[model samples]
Target: MFSYCTDPAALDGLAWFSCYLTTGKHMSIYYAVGTVLLLLAITAPLSLAFGFGGATAARSQILPLRWFGNTYIAIVRGVPDIAFFLFFVIALDQAFEYLRHRIKCPDWEAEVWQGNDFIVCAAAKLPLGNAPQWVHETYGFSLAVLTFAIVFGAFAANVLFGAMRAVPRGQIETAEAYGMTSRQTFWRVIVPQMWVYALPGLSNLWMVLIKATPLLFLLGVEDIVYWARELGGTKTPQFTDYPHGDWRMWYFLALLVFYLGFTKISEVVLDRIMARLTHGQAAAAGEAQRKAAA
Candidate 1:
């Protein structure tokens, strides 16, 4: 980033540090921050959509639909998240390849699981065997995002389901009395009122989702943690221009500050949202707002 950074070995003090931080590997660390932010932006809404659908389905009039939704929530939430992450990514990846194998290589007569190996045709490989590096990285990241969405979506579903139930029965009854159908009552009456109740739980879930971004390493993505360990490790003179002792502590300290700042900002935003949602509702929060305004 600096003209003075041309020779890292000759530099000293702040100049040396400046050149060190400007290295290509360190640039990747900055990009990793953006990656984390991108994952959060995409995953939040996707998880919410999944949760909403799961919560609505759990309350469906049809028995089978309700059973399916309930089972989804129960099973996913019941299992440890790490276990689910490890299992689901492999399963979903194989399942995708299996479908592709059926479509691309119908004539092939090989079993997919042949004694500890998942054998699929070359055409069936996701991104193909000769695909570019970016394709492979994107495929892995996509799988990680889906795993996060599914696991957290289950928790969000449980929060939303309870929130839906917490809406006063009288409100729903009044909608029914006003000639609203079940669907209409749900959308117009129940949905609007449930947000205030759900906000706290959802806020907590959002924090959890933020914290869970580090787990991306487990999914084979070269995330911030991977970069920190790589760049901060002891680098001998033979390896590169920049040589440093174990700096993992400093790297981790920076990460800690990053998360703390992110969560604090989130706290401010969610508090404002909660206050806005509380206006004119029957909940105690809404009542407090009304009294304060008076």
Candidate 2:
């Protein structure tokens, strides 16, 4: 926000708008946009890592490992994501506090759950009763991040499992025939080759992850959607120097633009990755590269 303008009345049309958009609340709105982007950045890799592990687990010849992996993917698909988010955040939070309550307030226990409210000792609070506001915000954000990672990680695992299976089985056998150990063949051959098949599903999952960032609001994370709705509401001249009409539509539009720009960039990046993945494979993309080279 520009200094030199002490009063909102000093600002004219566009300046008024700029000042309005740059208010502390609006600055938080801007940060909220970053918050959503950072969420996608964090969730994407973490989900991919999880998916890889889960896919590996599901593929194991060992029955118990396979059952566990398959069950993880299936359970998430069965539950509604919103329900999982709602239930898990509170459940996880309370679980943490309950554990803390046991450790911290072992002597003074009047039951953790008294009807609807989850009462924990002051010391057992997630951010503590007297913690800074920022600490609470950070804690909420951490929960949101964990929620996103867990939900999307399951979906990613499903996609990756399919991708791993879609890789030609003969190639793995060929590696075995060449005297490569099972683990060596998995890393050196199957793992590297699986991406060509994985890219399509993973990219789609990424797009879904991008759109789902708005759900952070439902989790009380005060993300862009939350701030946009808050600051974009009408403000009276009596209440504030800058008065405005209902601006939720405008704020939502801005969010739409932000998401579109993010997805466009993601598309470009995923395309590049796919290009690299398909460079020497027997897919049409690899054939085209060969043709060009020839």
Candidate 3:
């Protein structure tokens, strides 16, 4: 990383450490932390939105909608998350390319699938074959985000569906007696009350989501885990400015601490949010708060 790092053999001590951390590969690894956080920030809300929609659909009177929603929720719980991540990313990428192929090369005479290979026309390649490096990276990251959202959304749907059901039926009846339409009662009465019931489940889901971010490496994203392994491995002096013994344990230790800190902070925030959501409600948490106040 240092301009003085022109010759690896010439450097030693602090200069070597300085140059080692500043290397291009190491810099990219540092930036990969941001990639993980970005994935979390974007995926969290989108997943919740997907969950809410699925939960609503599951509760719908329409038979087909309920079936679809139930299927979505059931599939995730039944399947291992790693299996979904692996299968979905490949399937989704191919699905996109196939759609693009049909749209862009309708006249192509050859079949798109040859043996195990899924070959699409050059024009149908995602981000195009000649696209910039960043475009390819961005497209891959977007797919990863979508994959994470879909998988987690199903779990969230289950949690939210139960929360919706746990909202007392009396609340809905009371709203109906007050002349509220089904829509008004759902939004005003059921939705608001369900959060108090839902907070614990949602908080657990959030912590799981945080823990799952490391799986980004599986999706081919250069995430922190990938970097940790790469940078922590011993390198010969011929290949790097700073070469040393295996330090993977230390790097992983840092990751462990990072996650523990993140989850601890999340626990605090979720507790505050739960308290706010339960305020003045009829739930045990709310009752306890009122008792403390009295």
Candidate 4:
């Protein structure tokens, strides 16, 4: 912040705006942007991994494993995301504390569920009662990331399951005829060919995931939307310096620009990835690429 910021009232025009934008709270808004990006970066791959596992399990020859995978995908996909986020976070948090309580306070005799409230021993408090602010924030963030992964993973699993099936049966037969075991056939022929079919659905899922970042606000994470609404509200001089009228429209406009720009960049990247995956394959996309190259 500039030295002129010391007397915000005396400042005007660009000087006033510069100091206003550099305030501690404003810096928090900047950090919130990074928070959103970080959430996406961590959640995307985690969700994909979960999806891959679910899809693999769903396709397993073992009846119980297949049932488990199918049930997971069906239940998660059927539930509304907002309902899942709200319920799952509380349930998961309590589940963790319950396990810890059993281990750390086995001698304690108080009931965990008392009509309305869920309580655990002080020793079992996540991050402890005296942990630093950042630890609490990190714990909440981790929960949000897990919740996002689980929910999106279900959808991704469905996409991948269908993609896996779409791989030509003849390819698997050919691989097996070449002395490949079932595992070898899947790894060599099925896995490589499935991506071209999966990419379209996965790309749409990526876009949905990006849009869903705002739900972090509901999860108690101070994301960009939270900061935007807080900072954009009408700020009277009675409350603080550099007061401004309602500016939420401007704040949200910036968010719109950010999301649009980010998704546009994602589209370009996904297209390139799709091109790479399709290269030299037998799919229609591969045929088109070959024609274009020729």
Candidate 5:
């Protein structure tokens, strides 16, 4: 990044360190930080939307919809996260390719499953075989995002379902007494009240989601953890410019700091949200706030 970065061998002290930190690989580490944040930004709301749908479905009067919602929450929550992450990505990828293969290659002679290998026609390849590097990266990142949303959504659904149930039965009855339909009671009374109950669980889920960002490496997204390990490993002058000893401890330390700082910020934000949601309500938190104000 600097004119003097050209000759790393002669530089020493701060000069050498500056050059080392400005390398192409180091820039990638910086970019990976953004990648981690982007994953969280995209995944959080998508997961919440999924959770809302699942929770609503679980509460539906329709037997089949309720069964589906209950089964989805049960299966996802029961499975270990790592196991789900690994299994679901492959299954989803194959499902996509298989659909495309059937649609695009209807007349093709080759069986998709030949022995142990799963093959698809060239045209049906995700991002296509000859696509640019960015397209391939985008495809992988999209898959990672979807995987995260599905897994986290199930947990969120559980939290929301309990929250929905916690809304006072008296409130629902009062709404009905006022001639409100069930849908109107749910939308007007229950939905507003549920947030005060849901905030704590959702807050915890947010922290868990933040911590899970490292799993992006497993999904081939080149997230911060991946870059940290790659850049922190022992390097020799023989292999590349700007050689350094094993610095993984320091790199990982930075990651540790980043996560803690992010988590702290989230806690602050969630606390304020909780405060807002609880304001003017009859819940313990709201009562406490009222008492303190008085």
Candidate 6:
């Protein structure tokens, strides 16, 4: 980044370090951190929406609807999440490719699973065999994000489902007494009140989602972890213009700090939201606020 970094070999001390870190690969690593943030920004709302639908399904008045919703939430919780990430990405990908294969290569007579290999015509490939590098990365990243949304959505659903139940029965009863129908009671009385109770669990789930971002590396996305490992290592003359000793520990230390700061910030924000939600409620926090006001 600095003009003095022109000759990495000649540059010494901070100069060599600056040029080394500014290399294209290192720049990619830096950009990957932003990718992590982007994933979180996108996934949070998507997951919340998924969770809301799941919770609603579980509480639906219809028997089959309730069973389906409950089953979706229950099955996701029952399975190990890593297993789901691995299986679902591949399963969803293959399913996509299979459907494409069916249409694109109708004349081709090759089974998709021939023994251990998943053989499909090149025409059915996700980004196509000859597509640009960016498409492949985009495809992989999309799958990773989808996987994250699915897994975290399930956890959020469970939290929300409990939160919905936490809404006082009398609140619903009072709504009905006011001539509100079942749907009206749920939407106006239950839905609005549930957020306060759900905030704590949802906040915890948010922390978990933050921690889980690193797992994106396993999904083949070039996230911060990938960059930290790639660029943080000692460079030899053969590998780069600047040579250094082992520094992965320091790189990972940075990652730890990054995560800690992120989690702490999230905690502060959630706490503030909780306080706002508790402003006039009959919860403990609300009672404390009322006493302080008096």
Model 3: per-residue lDDT, tens digit, 13-77?
88877887788888887799899889999999999999999999999999999999999999877
Tell me how far the alpha carbon of residue 235 in candidate 4 is from the true structure, in angstroms, after superposition.
0.2
Instruction: Write model 6 residue lDDT over 1-294, tens digit each, in one string.
Output: 777877776777776777877878878977888899999999999899889999998988899989988888888889998888878899999999999999999998767899989988999999898999999998998998888888888888898999999998988899999999998988898889899988999998889888888889779887888788877788788877767788899899999999999999998999899999999999888999999999
Model 5 CA deviation exceeding 4 Å by range: none
The per-prediction tally of clashing pairs is 0, 0, 0, 0, 0, 0
Q: Report the lDDT tens digits of candidate 2 across residue range 124-205.
A: 9898878999999989988898888888888889988887777788998999999999899989988888788888888999
**How many Å off is the CA of 102 in candidate 5?**
1.0
Candidate lDDT scores, in order, read 0.93, 0.86, 0.90, 0.95, 0.93, 0.88
User: What's the C-alpha lDDT at position 20 in model 1?
Assistant: 92
State the local distance difference test value for candidate 2.
0.86
**In model 4, which residue pairs have backbone atoms overlapping below 3 Å?**
none
Q: Which stretch of 10 consecutive residues in model 2 shows the poorest summed lDDT?
A: 1-10
Pairs of colliding residues, candidate 6: none
Q: lDDT score, residue 263, model 6?
A: 90
Q: Of the candidates shown, which would achieve the greatest lDDT relative to the real structure?
A: 4
Better of 2 and 5 by lDDT: 5
lDDT of 5 at 273: 94
**Higher-ranked by TM-score: 2 or 3:** 3
Q: Residue 73 lDDT in model 1?
A: 98
In model 4, which range of ten residues has the least summed lDDT?
169-178
Q: Could you tell me the C-alpha RMSD of candidate 4 in Å?
A: 0.8
Model 4 lDDT tens row, 33-59? 998999999999999999999999999
